[model samples]
Each structure stands twice: as structure tokens, then as C-alpha cells.
Target: MELRDDQPMQHEIGNRTYIVADVDPLDVDGVRTVEVGSALWLLGFLALLPFYGELEANGRVWWLWACLAGFGLGLFGLEYCRRRRKARAERDGLDHG
Candidate 1:
């Protein structure tokens, strides 16, 4: 069976038919997401700072370090996503001033 370009996907498996929506994906560049994530991670690390001694006593100090790592990695991801979004916009002629 043929489906129209704008039609949702329909798959029949076993005794059930699944219909997937044919909606367009969001055009987010992910820079904001990364920034928010990085901020959250930094917040988590700061919030855990006061309990550092207890964390070290319990051998869970890695949790704080993990948050720092997440923030660092998110910084890298933010830059990459920003560059990717710029390139995509330029390619699609959506970078108009």
C-alpha cells in the first residue's frame, strides 16, 4: 500500500496496527538546551559543596566531580551545536539579517 507524503505512517504487526504521527521535528539548535543543562549541572555541584566532607566520608565525592564533568562537556556540546546551527541556517538561507 502507498501512502501520501503528508500522511502518517501505518504499520501492522501481529494483531495491532500502529499509526505514527507525520509531524515535523522541532527546529531547535540545542544550544539553549546545552546551556540549561550545563547551568543545572553547575548548580548541582554548588549545592553539593557544603556536604563535601560527608560525601568524601561516604566515598561519594565522585558525584560532585561528575557534575563538573557534565558542565564541562555541555560547554563543548554548546559550542558544537551553535556552529552546526549556524552552518545549517546558512545552507538553508535562513541566516538573513
Candidate 2:
């Protein structure tokens, strides 16, 4: 894991060599973030519903539908990430069925 000075990622700035940090990526599975996003999109759709008439008149009604679509897609992503996290945990012998 040691990076040499000749590595492509090594940078020399003012006689100082900067190399990429050796760190493991996060494994939070992103379910919480997806839930938050889905909630926000749902809230946006609900908030815009009251102004549907104005939005349609101004030809911006797609914004509301877009929010709904985002919420729906987020729902799918949430389930997918949750399943992935659970599978990983089970495979690692961390969480038993």
C-alpha cells in the first residue's frame, strides 16, 4: 500500500510530495441518506401540490411530477441499498437471520 514518488497520483508542489491518503471507503450503505432524500422529494411534491394551478398556468407543472418521480425512485434505491447492507452484514457473520 506504500506509494512511491514516481506513482501517477504523487504530486510535487514546492518540493513537497503529496500522495493519496490510504483509507478504506465508508460502508454505511447509504440507506439513511436515501430515506432522507425520498422524504424531501415527497415533501416537495406535497408543498407544490397547492400551487398546481399556478404551475400548470406557467408551464412548470413538470416540477411537481419530477419530485414525485424522484421520491418513487428513491424508494427503490432505499430498498436496494438496505438489501445490499443486510447481505453484506450476513455474509460477514455480523448479523444472523
Best by lDDT: 2
Name the regions of candidate 2 deviating beyond 4 angstroms: 1-11, 19-24
| lDDT tens readout by residue for model 1, 1-97 | 8756757488899999999876777888788899999999999999999999999999999999999999999999988998999899899989732
Looking at model 2, the pairs that clash are none
lDDT of each: 0.90, 0.91
TM-score of each: 0.77, 0.76
Q: How far is candidate 1 from the true structure (C-alpha RMSD, Å)?
A: 3.7
lDDT by residue (1-94, candidate 2, tens digit) is 9855555666789989998775666778898899999999999999999999999999999999999999999999999998998899988988
